[model samples]
Target chain A: MANILTQNDIQHVDYKDIDLLKQFVNPHGRVMSRKRTALTAKQQRAVEAAVKRARFMGLLPFIQK
Target chain B: MEMETNLSEEGGVSRVYEIGYLIVPTVAEDSLDKVVGEIRSSIEKAGGSFIAEGAPSLMRLAYDMTAREGDKNVDYDRGYFGWLKFEASPESAIALEESLRTNASVLRHIVFRTVREDTRAKIKAPTLREVKTPRTTLAAPRREEEVSAPVSEVDLDKALEDLTTE
Candidate 1:
């Protein structure tokens, strides 16, 4: 199945956009990969980078309690 | 984890980096600016020039950070979050990280090589200062007394009070 990001025709994922990235992050604050999220390989890579950047900026946590 | 280098418009060797750093929330808004200034100065000393993305915003931490103060454990619940994009060489990146690590006001910081964009930043390195002192303005540089003195809590109180009065 095509992921929602692609279905909606979103081009590049933004690391600073926390609201959009939150959907792909698991409860534990980890970004889900293509296997679980069904994102295209390219999109998955973008999401991965976005999530990591968000974590470092404290928009998201390394681990959630 | 991988370092990618590219030529720039100025024909100087420079690489872009994404820097994310956290400041402890206990610092007053006045002192916070000082902390940021110090960090930026260190970055300049290490040959990195800051590219302003935006102003940093205060944020709540996702997990509790408990640390031992004098006797009781203090929880760092909130922090000032900032993101910066800068251009520098690989060696300067190391120096930048080291400076951030030593500063107590910085609770956390991370630096990584970001994918380069088309915009080019001029590459120039600042001279190394022999005396390590907390810097202020350019005029007169600093006072003789302040050069050897450390940042005292009384100064912090004065700065914090300024926030309320004005």
Candidate 2:
């Protein structure tokens, strides 16, 4: 599996402040489902909403197809 | 003196009332101006004294209505906000509400009574508060609370014993 946390691992992906988002997210890029980043469903939703708002405001890049 | 007594005894013919309505977004902007003009005429005809008006704000609806006549596939409709404050008889408000309910242009309407003498007085005589109040410092209260708590006797004894031993 490609390393999700590393910016280099995602090819042609659009992300606003890739470094900042990486720092906020888990090392695996996948949040939760692990003990190190023990975030619940609510926390996940908050993160998703923040990311969506950032994208809509042009602060973050939308994921490229 | 007899006319004044009769007028006072009859409970007067005036009351301060507020009417507000929301216009559907589908209504053209030009149509909105026309609707407002009609309302102005309606108020004048009803013998209501217009006081003030509130500006429009874009707000989300609590629920979506699927049954607008012109809109076939409307997921939702935008509400154009408006408010009118006036002095009129209670019966006039009832008549206005009935008219608004029958009108297709209005998305929602409500009328409320404002009878507080102080509220009306403030309208006529404005207060002078030209200067904005400065925000108070929060850190000062925390520091004062910390200083007010009594020191533990055990801790004081321990400090004195350490000094003597040294």
Candidate 3:
């Protein structure tokens, strides 16, 4: 799939946006790699940080069994 | 005044921080304002100035989370979520976090350094590209069989010439 953030012109990823962040996570609740997501290094870092923050706030699950 | 002097003596530099929190679902809706007011007052007490905030709203949690209450742990499937952006000295920020940690009404919280400008993503619709199909024949469209057939050397050269001229 094409880069969703690049396609939508999204520069910064907000941790509160769990709906959008969920797309980058796998069934196990693990973050997808840059290769799998086809995102730039900067974009990948932003997504990683946002996901971690969301997990801390219980907005996203850390592990999905 | 005393706190300001102490901070200045330590050469403390104020930095922007955003705190996101989850309030225990047990809190009555009518008393939600009182809880929010407590947080705002704490920020002011810490010499922090508010930049922006999202009022607490009830929301379902992604998974069941347990927080200690008295001697027992209570599982929660929902909570009031909210966030606030402010500027405060690093020392005061840490102190503010400590205070929140002891508040029984707070289920979870996170504070991190951030910029004053809004950095949240604004998703937009993807723009579609128009594709142009080249017409191989001017007369009746070439049959599907002919379309897949190999082009002659003459046609290849003509196509190259057309591309270069364009």
Candidate 4:
């Protein structure tokens, strides 16, 4: 299947939006299972990578410490 | 298992540092090189290697810092955000913090520790590299014009004259 995230989709997502992150991740800090999210493995990985980058840049909260 | 534990704990892998600093805006633009050099030398002296430096990003302070002896009444710092990832002893890290704190040029600073292993492994394990879109010729000139604007050297004399006239 064609990956759900196109280049434009990734470009529009700044790796900083909290709601976009929540769509791919759970409050428990785990990536949402691909079956539930309906994302191909590649798109899933991309979402996970973007979330990590967002957390690193202080744009997203990874875990409550 | 004990041997593995000892090896893992020996140096415990180096901690990565991400440091940011704010300096006085009135400082001459040309002097940034000297200031950054001084900071790098200090980090190196404490056994750290500088990794990455970012372009200065202008920022506003969350709160005003009260002026004391030499400080002006208003704290207006133009942030020159730099990122340095280095390996150093914990003692050296403490010294680095102290040096940044004492420097008159630096208005504020913070050091965050991160893991290099994750970053390193991500880099080493190659994935499909996307080819960048070819730059259109028409777009290149616009970018160059924007870059070539002598923003740093514009109208200093006129600005000073304006101040005097006022």
Candidate 5:
């Protein structure tokens, strides 16, 4: 799939937006890597940071339970 | 009092803030407002000015969070959700966080400094992540004495010989 960011024309990702965050997460709740998602280096980093924040805030789980 | 790292690029010394908090769903609508109002007052008390906010909405939590009510452990499966965008002095933001931590009705919360959507800029590359505490895969401790010892063949043979001798 094309990188979700460019496909949707989303420049910045918000940690609070679960809908957008979900797209970056795998079925097992792991965040997809740049290689897997085919995201640019910048986009991948943005997702990683957002995912970490979301997980810490309980918006997303570190692992599927 | 503490200070946020980001200084406003806008026409002020204070930074813009985004706060997200989850409240236990069991609270009545009136009581919910009361709790939020308390938070608002606390923020103001610390010298923060309130900005517009979305009304709190009841939502099912992704997972149950255990909360202690009196002496009992209460499992909160649902939560009242809300987000506020405001401008506050760094000192007041720190105070707001301290108050949120002590608020009993709050199940979880997070706060951060943010730029306006219109002025949002390029993304920054992140460094490798560090390992953190595990959220799952619990290993309960088991004492060796609690496990029954396995019976050996020698022991069984000795028991048979002892019975015959008797």
Candidate 6:
């Protein structure tokens, strides 16, 4: 599968963009692996960091339950 | 996490930091500005200069969060979210974060080093690509089988007879 960020030409992964970030998170509220997300290593890192930040801000949950 | 700070030749250290905070939802709409202003003043007091900011707006939380209010822990399902981007020395930024932790009005906050440039991606609807059918004038060359003329009944009978005989 094509890398979503690369396909969209998204240069920055922002934690405030919950909708976009949700694509990188699984239903369990865990960040998906690079193989699953089909993201470059750098892109995966950025997404992971953004997801963690979003979770801290209560914009995203740490766990679904 | 290790803090990243830029040290100038003059021995001064500073870094660009962005702080995102959640204000208690109990604050009245009219007094929201005052709470935001207090945050600004606190940053200013820490010797930080403002760069950009997002005003606090009421938003639903993903989960219930509890914050101490005087004598009791109050559960909140919503909050006023805001952020400020500024330049400050590493020491002062840490100091400001410590102060915000103790602030009763602010339920949660985070300060992280970032660049001055706007790195946020604009949310936009995906554009649908137009599907174009091949034009008749530019149609692909037909295969031999498809381009071949239909066999006459006599020719078909002759071919069948020949096959049977073989």
Query: DockQ for each candidate?
Result: 0.08, 0.01, 0.35, 0.06, 0.10, 0.38
Q: Per-prediction TM-score, chain A only?
A: 0.89, 0.43, 0.96, 0.63, 0.91, 0.95
Model 4, position B120: C-alpha lDDT score: 22
- TM-score attained by model 6: 0.77
- What is residue B13's positional error in candidate 3, in angstroms? 0.6
Task: Please write out the lDDT profile of model 1 over residues B1-166, one tens digit for every residue.
Answer: 2345756665657888877788888888777778888878877887677765545568887666664555887788788887678888777788888988888777788887775442211211122112345455444544566455677999989999999899
**Fnat for each model:** 0.17, 0.00, 0.70, 0.00, 0.20, 0.55
How should the candidates be ordered by DockQ, best one leading?
A: 6, 3, 5, 1, 4, 2
Estimate, for each residue in B67-151, the C-alpha lDDT of model 4 and write its tens digit: 2437546555234544566666666778889998788776556675644432221211122123456778546655444455564
Off by over 4 Å in 2: A1-65, B1-12, B66-77, B116-166
User: Which 10-residue window of candidate 2 chain B scores lowest in summed lDDT?
Assistant: B120-129
Tell me which residue pairs clash in candidate 3: none
Question: What tens-digit string does per-residue lDDT give for candidate 6 at B8-30?
Answer: 55587989899999999989989
Compose the digit string of candidate 2's lDDT tens values, residues A1-65.
Answer: 22222223221121223343333444433333424333344444444544443333223345432
What is the lDDT for B73 in model 1?
A: 74
User: Chain A TM-score for model 2, please?
Assistant: 0.43
Shift of residue B89 alpha carbon in model 5, Å: 1.4
Candidate rank order under lDDT: 6, 3, 5, 1, 4, 2
As a whole number from 0 to 100, the lDDT of residue B44 in candidate 2 is: 80
lDDT on C-alpha atoms for all candidate structures: 0.71, 0.52, 0.83, 0.56, 0.74, 0.84
- Angstrom error of the Cα, residue B129, model 3: value is 16
Per-residue lDDT of candidate 5, residues A13-37 (tens digit): 7776777777778988899877778
Candidate 5 residues lying further than 4 Å off, grouped into runs, are B1-12, B118-166
Ranking by TM-score: 6, 3, 5, 1, 4, 2
Q: List the residue pairs that clash in candidate 6.
A: none
Return the clash pairs for model 5, or none.
none
Docking class of 1: incorrect
